[model samples]
Target: MDDPPRVGSTDVAVLPSDGGTNQPTVTEAPTTPTVTDSPAPTGDRTDPEQVAREFMTTYPRDVRELSDPTFLASLEGVNTALLDQVTDRSLEQAGHDSDETYERYAYTVTGTYQGQVQAFYSMVVARPAEPGEGGGAAENDLPFQVHSFDWAPGMIGDEDRPGPAAGKPVPITTEEREELIGQVRTDVIDPILTFDPDESPEQRQERLDELTVEPSTVTPPMSRSGRYAMIKETLSQTYSTEHGGPITITYAGTWVDPYDPTHNGSWSLTAAMAREDDDGFVVRSVEETAPSEGSG
Candidate 1:
């Protein structure tokens, strides 16, 4: 028989993905990146929120903790569809909350699983002192423990789209495709264009010019901060110059990342150069777009 809804059960109740109206975001699917092994948290864990955050950050349970048994119990209310996702191999951005009512916890989790699918859902916990056990008779004995978990299932394979057609009057060879990608990196991508919603073309160019010829400004984490982001994978192909005159041979491609291995997003670009000229294959422009659902 299913367990009864108790004090902390409300915390485990399914929550909205957007946390608005307490409604789930069912209309839109989530993104799935490829699963990758990430470092786990170690050291002191004196707080319940800390433990729950750790569970959400690097979930899938590479190693269980003393708190896991109760944490798992808290999850009993979660549906099987969503519970299956708890074995996440790679978790994405997670949101969390706790209630004073029952000392409850709620987590909105998303991550990549082994099959390259995005598993998203919610986990709620009703955290309160359990019946007195002999181990610690003292009232002040402290250790924020979990009593139960509530769950709500989200999407499994989202954040992926369809591939672009490689239809060109003349098909470029595999070698040509690789060559074109390399050229695009230097001529177009290297100079780098920062995305700005309101910025104009001239403004973008001006901003690009002001920057030094250095890689992007992302600061590499000194160590595993437990923060995770899905790595997006790119695949490319080239077309014949005959398809488009001045455009020469067009290069088209699709994106497939760690999550949602099933979906592929479209991307393409054009360049101008002679057939035999390697350096001459200068990039005229490039376009890397994400699906409306949003993916790498």
Candidate 2:
């Protein structure tokens, strides 16, 4: 008997040319090469939803960090100018809160702007005030960065409305206007005019927190030396306060300097107010208006 065919050989029967008996022949078959699939191409970094999600996940919670120039440079395709404007406004409003935790949730591509995808997102952030802190911990809808080439970030105004469209200025009733003005007086004007010579740092911060929606809006006017006794009155309503809009109140005032009476002079200020949840209005920003004509 012929030796058994080798392990990798194919067995075949061959007949001799003289046609006598059939002989078994072993033939080697070509080895088939192994095939493997290469890993799928890495996910497209330019994908719009992917970029937005990555941005939200890695976004800096600290306002100071967001202000860094590198923060915008790290983004792939963002409108730095538009983003900076919105971010600066938002930081001015809520930058001073302590112990902030941001959680990104639902997101959708709203539309395309300037050939770039615009993504609108919703996130729940926990801003927990420190122990003995006046504001306390609250969950509110705040402005967050949106990814787009030309569109600015969408701000969350109310819980019912999820996008930037929610906060458009709406007409306010006469009663509502009076109520808002009262809030500005109690929450903003009074705080600015009142000066405590012996106030502690903690006490001053608590007072500021009580005045504005966030403590960061107004700086505590206190120092070791004598503080200026500010006198503010003659409030003029330059712009109507609308619901879900900004309230601009211009005040004519004078600053009294105890050390140098000559330094005391007439001054004017404009306080910009924003609606804070359902709790009336609160001062969001304060800027010096051009002083009106007056004698020193």
Candidate 3:
């Protein structure tokens, strides 16, 4: 007989304890550890604006800390008691139906290396569950789920076009501009196309048409490594926003259809110092995609 195999998280396993034993020996049964799903967090303020502000402040700090991969990995053994509390409460208040549903709203870094941030924004098309079957919350019923979750540094940011409005015409500060551009090229664009398995030849052509860029002409080649240059060249034009604060800079421009550059689309990019980290800033999140490059 051989040593009994250890049971795993999924199910129990049985094995002989000794090869030479004449009589059958019983091995101690593995005990199942009790795991209680934690409760959610609660906010004291009733105002939505106040809640949003609090969320903006606290989450960013957490994000800043999460930027450190080695430190984050080492914390795997530690219980996320407080973090779970807040996330759970927020989900419950929002009436999210299932943990899986909340996951759709949340983003995760799929793969990363060398301190570069890698991520993907995916569509979570969850249908409403029937009665007696668990389903996502009312809010979860959408064509697509969206959120910006960064796994590593230099993961994502603004396209190379104009800065967000609300600042001087030469909107971005010297230090801030470089950081913002770094993020856009490294973080936001890389992950989306890298994980886009369906973006094959046919899909690439379709993407070209959708993005309104010339097909068959590989200005710099559209591989993941060269996507930043392609995107930068594609979106060189700029626009600005009306409102302003914190000397922030925002820009509005067209998201070109990569497949067909002749077509026009509308898009916007914004840049500002991260409220949590004095040295950092984020591109917020993106909004709708249009057909042409100029306005999309």
Candidate 4:
């Protein structure tokens, strides 16, 4: 008869040397090995601010460094298009050369290359962070990724138009705010918006004359104060972050229509007063527009 089939590692059959009987023999089974997986160093970190700051610091100045593995973690949350944007712009500003320092925004050249940047700037803005779900703090809620990345033509610092006002917005009290509103009415809205048209030229002259005297004689607009709010009232600065972009007290308000005083339409006015160190706030400009920019 054919010999008994052999089994794998589990058991072996031994032929009896005495020819008495075929018996099975068992040998020790081989030992199984243990295994463990190691994760990447920065793959598990949760601090978005730290990660972003680090990424900005370590990101390569040379375009070639984009493929470097050392920066993989820092660029974890950034998208390819944004990365490409920065790379392209930086290279353009740096004159297609290597970047040297982030010390003071001169990021186009290092001692390694001949580069100088006079009119280029790059900015990174991150969105505000919020807490994760389940109430308690968690990494998922933090603004762990860049929200906006842009390359402007010139450097933007506190010294610029809006930059100058960036010097700690000056806080004003409720009384001061009211006073500003009153000033806005007397100096701004009353002149262009409050005019009756039917009133005699002398009356208009009187109104204009009143403006010359201190404590402005013009009766402030009735609903102007309540209707209009300071554009930068809460910003804590004399200047508003509006298009004009200066240290100016600016406001917009509506007045009851003289023609349609009952309930038809109203006059909308936007006024601005500049802030000078010596003169303080002065109404220097005013413009009238349709009720709203759009007809609707």
Candidate 5:
């Protein structure tokens, strides 16, 4: 008998005929299927995450000319006209950009609007031109973009106008709530309340200069020193004394409805505090509304 066929080799056999010469027959072995890698999934242009990333990368460059139709077109699903309007208003409020060059960005999806994902986009950019050493990105959440609003003021009650979809409630732990309250009191309220009556106008103005960020629309409490003592006394009697007597802090994770012009972005923290005043129970608040540090 022929030697056992080698592995994967065709088998040969001899066929005997009654009166004819023997012929060779060949049998083929089974072939193995070829393997190939499936093509990688293409980045979906409509995917909100993908779009948000692209936006973060491109916005710093595009913001220089926010009204450019070509630039606006790149922002898919955005209201171009409204974007232009807001850009004009923003420029009026914040003034033109200087020499800051944004190189890196981080973003978090906070909510969705009009079926598009909304995010807070933060960037690492050259700090404002300063003497001695250069400044870095603010340690606190001062500068960030509310992607859902297209970095513009969102529509409040204009049902006729296109607006962002209503954001879902963001849940936070009690610890988080307490922490945020502390931050508001420390970063926002303390600076407002800690003023010296003896300080001259120039000294007070210097203090205001330190506290005020560009495009500050909210009237700083330092501007109203007359009420500082009263506000402090009222707060002390209302909230916990150990924590510097913060007001009753009502924290909203995202934006407040009706569109607060004072707030920087939708994701900015807003706290409403109740205090006893001559007008009975009234709301006293200082909206920091900046994103947290290193969040970018």
Candidate 6:
């Protein structure tokens, strides 16, 4: 049987040999650039949404790419339509600046795996509040920080989508998605994001122990402090009130590796119910389920 759903899961593709130059054309700091509509061209395959989904799927597995400038540059052959969709949706969902200009900083690049085509997504975010005037060496040198990521499954690959046998496959239910996300926050992502090397070992263990327990759907842990709290709050309000039904989520990427300090070296998969609860959903329990065939 397949493992249950759990929490998890950006774009950018730039194609080579196209009319446009490979080097970045826009140089100004991305302080809300005026985005213009591009002339329609033929044969664009890389889609932003697909790129985002691809980003989710691949990023965790290839952590080295995060720091690789050349690898980041090579992913330009992706379909912009998918890339745009995913970036637009994520930016809106994250409440980051979602203006069309943001797309200029995003890209979709494709890769081949097992004779199959895959995509990677990335965003070049401008660092906030830098010294010195705009449009100078600082602007040219690492002006926009490149955060490279992979396509997430549900939104990009065949596995993430509804099976053709099932008709337009149902998206993993929002309730299920949110619940899994909550558990991930509590158990994995949040702890690692908030870890303080300065804290006493006992305190660290205490926090880790708290994480081992299943989290309440209504009040989940957050990875980093500050804005992360707001993300949690937003999820709580959006999901618990509307989609707070029984659901399960599974951690599918780097989150599963034990050696990784990136996310507490733990990833989770969850199974949940279809309806809501008065106390809101509390994790009934946690256990390792059997992995699907071929995964083991």
Q: Which candidate has the highest lDDT of all?
A: 2
Compare the candidates by TM-score and give the number of the best one.
2
Rank by lDDT (best first)? 2, 1, 6, 4, 5, 3
lDDT of each: 0.33, 0.35, 0.26, 0.29, 0.28, 0.30
Q: Candidate 3, which segments miss by more than 4 Å at Cα?
A: 1-173, 189-195, 198-233, 237-241, 245-273, 293-296
What TM-score would every model get versus the actual structure? 0.24, 0.33, 0.22, 0.27, 0.20, 0.23
Candidate 3, residues 1-296: lDDT per residue as tens digits?
22212233212111111111111111111122222332232333322223323433354244322212211221222222223222211211111123321221221222223333232111111121222235434433222211112111122222454221111111122123224444443443333233243456566555433221112222222323433322333343121222222212333433333555544444443422212111122333322232233422
In candidate 1, position 169 carries an lDDT of 16
What is the overall TM-score of model 6 with all chains considered together?
Answer: 0.23
lDDT for residue 285 in candidate 2, whole number 0-100: 58
Of candidate 1, the 10-residue stretch with the lowest lDDT total is 162-171
Worst 10 residues of 4 by lDDT: 19-28
Tens-place lDDT per residue, model 5, 1-296, is: 12222222322111111110011110011112222332232364322233334444444345422111212222332223322222211111111122232211212223334454433212111111232234444322223221111122233223376333212111121122224345554554455445566776676555544332221223332222243322222122112212223224433222211232232222232333332211111123335544322121
| Candidate 2 residue lDDT tens string, 1-296 | 23312222422111111100011110011112222222232344322233344444444332322211212221322222323222211110111112223212112224333444443322111111232334333423232322111112343334665444333322222223324455565556667556776776678767665444334334322222555444444535333333333446666655545554444455555666543322223455556654533234
| Better candidate number, 3 or 5, judged by TM-score | 3
Q: State candidate 1's TM-score.
A: 0.24
Better of 4 and 5 by TM-score: 4
Q: On residues 73-140, what C-alpha lDDT tens digit does candidate 1 reach at each position?
A: 22222223433533543333233233222333334455554454443444432333332355432332
Stretches > 4 Å off in candidate 1 = 1-43, 56-101, 113-119, 125-142, 146-152, 155-296
The segments of candidate 4 whose C-alpha lies over 4 angstroms from its true place after superposition are: 1-179, 196-198, 201-206, 209-240, 248-263, 292-296
lDDT comparing candidate 1 with the true structure = 0.33
Model 4: what TM-score?
0.27
Error of 5 at 199 (Å): 1.3
Model 3 misses residue 126 by how many Å?
50
Candidates ranked, most accurate by TM-score first: 2, 4, 1, 6, 3, 5
Q: How does residue 10 of candidate 5 score in lDDT?
A: 28
